[model samples]
Target chain A: MAIAKICGTETEYGLRMLPPGDHNPVSISSLLVSSYVDEVQRQIDWDFEDESPGNDARGFSLESAMAPAVEAHLLNAVLANGSRYYVDHAHPELSTPECTDALELVRYDKAGEAILRRSMDAARRVLHEGASIVVYKNNSDGKGNSYGCHENYLMARSVPFAQIVHHVVPHFVSRQIFTGAGKIGSEARWWDRAEQAPHFQISQRADFFEEIVGLETTLKRPIVNTRDEPHADPQRYRRLHVIVGDANLSEVSTYLKVASTAIVLAMIEDGFFGEMDLTVENPVQAMHDVSADLELAKSFRLVSGRTVTALGIQWELLQLAKKYAAERGLDCVGGEERGSDALARWERTLELLEQDPSSLSRQLDWVAKLELLEAYRDRTGASWQDRRLAMLDLQYHDLRPERSLFARLDMERLTSDEDVDRAVREPPRGTRAWFRGTCLSRWPTQIVSANWDSLVFDVGSDPLRRVPMMDPLKGTADQVGALVAQAATPAELLRLLSE
Target chain B: MMPERELKKRSSASRQDEGDVAASAGAPPEAATAARQGERIKADLDDLLDEIDEVLEDNAEEFIRGYVQKGGE
Candidate 1:
């Protein structure tokens, strides 16, 4: 009944090159990305011809500088995996290819970490002695600033934006209980009524949110982002750009975050929540309040005039999800097995949240992080603001396998290293990414430039032939895997595709 | 020729880990004794702390103080 929920994630990693040589974040980020790109293949630049981040869903365009500035003097590389790895303003950002489901997203997301780790290794070899780069899959810099781990979901163009905001705001407010990569304390010191400041919060990005809906991501951040850049058929789809989440290191946390949100999107697309109101009285306050409630017992008043706990809100959503699955079958979040797994995990997570959240130390990032921090406190009796705790918080998200505290935890995993290695090189076969990636890997030297919906190939003389792949569902591995393998050159491949 | 690639289709069953997490998650909510689980968690935290001691940054306060960066969207 619902449209198949195609989704992806873009993570901007925190970059800090240790001591010695130059440690400007932007330069280090550029080095990390360009070094990795150059080591493997010819430089394949990202085409910014189609990106329209300025086109706000609220109607008129704000300013077109976000893309124009990135296009100039940026190390934007389109990966063989149909992902984009580049310097986003200052952070080294990696965006996964369009994934058909949440589970597929997990593998691709892990692959991104592998790529960044390799990038760090590559940068180290080229840098001066004692000058090394470090990357953290985290949101904030422990200062007043915060970056984003944004999720993009495809919604039917016909679905009104207001309806999306109305239905999704409450989930965004409450889902932080599990989606959060926990932090030490509030970043908004101005908003801190010091007596009431939470020592620790469930979400790293919660204090940063100040609006209910907005186009601004870095400032006056919104609970529901309104960026309307559909990198597909605009007449048929809407890309819901979500920038409120934390950069998670836990596989289960990432999985549940994407999967549950996908399920909710499916319900929204199918018009399943008929007249049911799940609105928070004030979403920005509710988002921060939910994050601050460590006891998980704070209640917020809803538009329906009933007050409910964040856990209560999640349970209500979960019940509706189960009913939607039973009635509609979860084809929207990718077939029965993956959908069922999402539903089951969602249920188990909520039940654990209510009965024993500490038990989820192995499943959720915030819980695992809290457990690690608390364990450190028990060992040394350090307060929340202790420098050791802050370092521990940042180290938990470090990208290095050996250095990453997340890697050491016995966390529940939805993907394997073997699978992640494959994902690092290959794209998921269900979408056009299969064709896009297959072409790039096979014709690496010949490809001149690439982007989300098209690939321009250099065929030695004739104008660069651009193969447009606007339909996200077409050009699957099932559809083009053999064709890609059989072709000897980009010229033949283009000819065959035309034929 | 294109490199030899494995499908590596991740199965739903792979979501289950070989840790106590999957076991406790699969167990009925009421059936898992919360108090005993709490004790086990306290015990596990002890084990985790031992591992953490080895991996923690040597100059933690200095490292954290110097870890600032330019944030982005």
Candidate 2:
């Protein structure tokens, strides 16, 4: 059987202070995060001692790929909602709490957006007159630089890194058919040819990735990232940090992005993909080409000399996942039911794409964005390179609910408004997040620092007691809710834990 | 301490599926049985809430009030 697919997302929102001139993003992002933390009154610090971003899974460490420094000066706060709301690399980042299933993850991701929206409001009060900060849930800045909306999945440590790379590379290259968040035009050097003009691409992050496999995220990003930080029992599991995905506004796209990837990971762990190597020759180039090809007909040669389109590859993966589920059951992708939902949606999306890509204009992010832009261009007689169109593209991702084009779209929502509202305040009950969130909610001031796998409590003692949550599946509501309710203060909780 | 609120509305979305997995691919019989066992394990291992609002009522009033308050005229 496959391991439980525990997962979460870390979204680094693009930020710019209004009257966008020579301004520092670091200061603006810090202001945004600080204002939110101040407004919520949950200003607990983040523990960064367990992070090991430089330890690559490819056996040898890249000495140049130094881990991110823990800047204690930055406004890094752990929310009572079991999330980390902070400034990461000069961008306002919201790392959702660990979730047991994809649907729960979607609710938390939406809550992150709500947090950003509130942060925008809080930041406005502190800003200078006629100057407000704006945040976008998109990947690129329309310049050469790109931010990330990274995904993390827990995989078993027994699986070889090489097999993970080989199996996942093809899916990463081709899954953009539905997972893409859509971009205005290409910025990669390879697309600078005279014959191939810069036009709308399917994915916003594809053009920026330069390497097939690497450790550096800001510079040369890899398709299958080799970062081996599990944040759990290291001997039992490995956390797959995927940096290649775009921040999707459409809920259906977000669901598919996490669910389908989880199913594939399960198949990989179960040894179900027997000799089915759909490895592309040059994944970096193919990733760009597949994104640029809107028609979904552009074919890339696989390692077996067989040419396959992105849609074709998705269809193959879907069929395999279906068979895997039929035999193994959809248990690893949450349960039989949720796994079935993923397959049904995956099949329907592929079926619609096969008929006409426009058929999915309401469900898929790229198609809807393309339709919106093209309709505007036709109505106003504007060229593809019109600056107004680019502005429209940027407005699609604006964090302000009323101004955001994505918010206005008739996209299928997997989560309810009430649930999303609750997720903004409460944590999921099935993981260690329950303990972390309940603690923060019960005794906010007593907690000094918290991270993915540990929490430090100040009990009016000289040395704070650190509770280790090394098991992602442990410390759930069933295990810790009674204990948390029974203990009142940090001292009592520590005593109870010791008992 | 506040009483645990009963969820009047279904907080967790109904994970209803349209169709079953099409077992067209040629997998051995053992694989199918292994998958069934996996399904049993999945159910036993994780205890998720059918009603998310039960545990989620702690800060609802504060959150909604804050949201409306922040939407200043």
lDDT score of residue A11 within candidate 2: 93
Quality class of the docking in candidate 2, CAPRI style: incorrect
lDDT by residue for model 2 (B3-52), tens? 22222111111111101222344444865654553343232212112222
Model 2 error, position A415 (Å): 1.2
lDDT per residue (tens digit) for residues A1-499 in model 1: 7778889999999887777344677888899998898887567877778888889897879874376545557788888898889888889999999999998999999999999999989988888888788889999988877999999998899999998998999999999999999998788754647757888889999989889998989888988888888988899989899998988888899999999899998898889899889999988888988998888999999989999999998898899999999999988788999999999999988988898788898889998888889889988999888988998889889987667778756577889899999999898999998888888888887888888899999999788899888888888998887888888999998888999
User: Would you estimate the TM-scores of all the predictions?
Assistant: 0.92, 0.86
Candidate 2 residue pairs in clash (backbone atoms < 3 Å): A328-B35
Worst 10 residues of 1 chain A by lDDT: A63-72
Which residues of candidate 1, in runs, are more than 4 Å off? Answer: A20-22, A190-192, B1-44, B51-53
Error of 1 at A328 (Å): 1.4
DockQ of each: 0.47, 0.02
* Tens digits of per-residue lDDT for model 2, A198-312: 4798998898788888777887777878888889999999999998899999888889999989988888988999978898988888998889899888999998999999999
Best by lDDT: 1
C-alpha root-mean-square deviation, each candidate: 5.8, 12.1
